[model samples]
Target: MVCDALDLDNEEAEEEMYKLTRSFVNPHRNFEIPTTNQVFKMETGKNDVSLFPGQIVTVQIMPEVIQVSKKAIPVHIPISSPIRIILHPMFHQMTYSKAVQYLKDKSNGSYVVKPTPKGFGYIAITYIVEKDKAGVSVGLRLEVEGCKYIYSDLGELIVQYVEPKARRAEDLMAHAKFKSSVENLNSLEMNPNHSSYGFCFDYEMP
Candidate 1:
């Protein structure tokens, strides 16, 4: 029987493989799983196996010997750049309240992108909508889908205001409208007096 051929006792192997695949797909993850490819040399005191693209192999995880070499391995996979709503010299790990406070006195249209405190691969874009006697700040939720960023109705409303035909968040990033807006916002001098002026936020799920 097929079940007889399988080594059911070694369940960690399957989990390790899944982790490896996840790490390959998203390099930003905290842990890494080694592959039998040239990019990762397996020093398991056995004959090394060469793997071609799209090839599959059963990996046996040796927890004791699973150590990556000090040599750097060049990853050929194309990873997307972090979504930066505004170009500012700030730390990418600030809280939501701090982010709001940073933009409290800024002019309308000023914005900041930060990782959502709720996590789960979601991000928040906080921007100033009204900067009159009473300032108004709006936070929009954005999700990372593979290499692209996407948002729902609220994001659509803002994107449509700049580009009526825009669909994906990448569209807004590439559009001249938002590019100009980012440049204008970046050009504005940051208020050094503000306590949270140098703090920002960015995060990736593992």
Candidate 2:
């Protein structure tokens, strides 16, 4: 007599097999279970992790789990494998001159965040300090050191001082009113009727 069907008689084994087969068929339906090796790799900065909205993952912060609510760029942080930073909507990739020109006609305090053209991981805050005047605009270098953002030009700690505190660039922008020369840039979605509509552009991650 053959014994191939013997295991099928066990209810627990049958249920487990069914679940495995279903997970294989629908990979997305399967829970995200990072292997020990995967966690090690992420901790060592050897790999990057991708996370989707509403997905929960276990992290090394006292071994706790967190759920993401929106799409974000995976940024490596010391305490976590892949932390997310929501870049401001006004963030763009433009040269200093272009950024200055974009803010030239706008009111003072109008600003935009752009990547420092010199290198990666460095950001610049280009704003119109004085409208309709020579040297009307200025670009301040913003650096992310570990979890804190350093604004060397301001000489004050960027992480502190901001009301309610700000962890990321987007948060800082929300607390501070650095209006965009291109109207509607403050909103999540663009509005067609805002002035300088042509300057509104989508932010492309570098």
Candidate 3:
């Protein structure tokens, strides 16, 4: 029975589109910046990237430890698997490619980085808009997959200086801003004014 169910489930998920995320608030509202961490320690004694919970970022799969043992034949293996790290890369136009290079370089030329057969790769590459507002970078932030390059600024999840304690009002406003981003993504998928990707975020509304 289990094997039969597995086959049926696979058949059901064969379709390209996910089951049209169903939610009353809208799918975009649910988009949260996935939890993230800094890829490397920086001079400032902090990790570089920042990601909110739920946002998605692609982390390359590379062989971390390559050991040449005393044995006649030394074997090397990767510590991690191909996965999208729930973090951000430094923003760059060719950030996707750079990311691939990072893995290639880090792995000492063990793996070749390329796009997965699935249209969407291990990582989801969605447009992240960070704008200057009142002397701060404020805009939509999420960890998604798609780029095959290493992002320098635009795409990477960067770590900024921690802000001093915000006043009650500031904190409230900050929370609202994040909520808005989620709402907007949900809205775009639902409305999808421009159908560039050949898929409409719209759903059959009852």
Candidate 4:
């Protein structure tokens, strides 16, 4: 008797699910998803460093060994995750320590420094002057060998990890527009030669 009652309950439940799905697909129904003209926005109350063309913004050297397969696409690893520990026959144990140390020694606090992971050292500076936005943009050119510099006409370069502090209504809207543009560039497939349209550094996926 209990088994029969359970079967009857299951059938009723399935019928209820089917009705719910049909209601969702009905064109006359309305959903509650919010719509926005804006796409991305910088965190409020952060400071901004005004950089200009030909200006240099120096940073500390940090290196990580990225693995590349047959096609040469960089194998991405999360920044929070520990690097893979490996042991090769020739070298009993291997870690990224050696690579990091090498770069640090080479940099030695130099303003003109090469980017780690090798061959990602070119810099591109751009000025954004759109009607809706205005700012200076800085980026790294990742598609060539050796070190080189280029100029662009894009808007401000907003680093995702950094906090931005611009409270003016115009600034907020412009920043939001700039953020969306950067995201669109970052979404493209890796192109070392002319990838200056987006961010040069790899980021940890949340």
**Top model by TM-score, which number?**
2
For model 1, the superposed segments whose C-alpha errors exceed 4 Å read 1-91, 131-206
Give TM per candidate: 0.24, 0.26, 0.12, 0.12
lDDT of 3 by residue, 1-206 (tens): 00011112223433311322222125464332222331211111122343322222222222235456776766797695444332333222334455454444232212222233343333222221122111122222322233322334332332221122123324543552333334454554565564422221122320
Write down the lDDT of every candidate, Cα atoms only.
Answer: 0.42, 0.41, 0.29, 0.29
TM-score (C-alpha, index-matched) for candidate 3: 0.12
> lDDT score, residue 133, model 3?
15
Off by over 4 Å in 4: 1-94, 107-198
Worst lDDT run of 10 residues, candidate 1, spans 197-206
lDDT of 3 at 136: 23
lDDT of 2 at 135: 20
Name the better of 1 and 4 by lDDT: 1
Cα RMSD, model 4: 40.3
Minimal lDDT window, size 10, model 4: 1-10
In terms of TM-score, which candidate is stronger, 1 or 2?
2
Tens-digit per-residue lDDT, 74-135, candidate 4: 88985863332223211112223442333343322111111233223323211112222211
At residue 137, candidate 3 shows an lDDT of 25
On the 0 to 100 scale, the lDDT of residue 173 in model 3 is 36
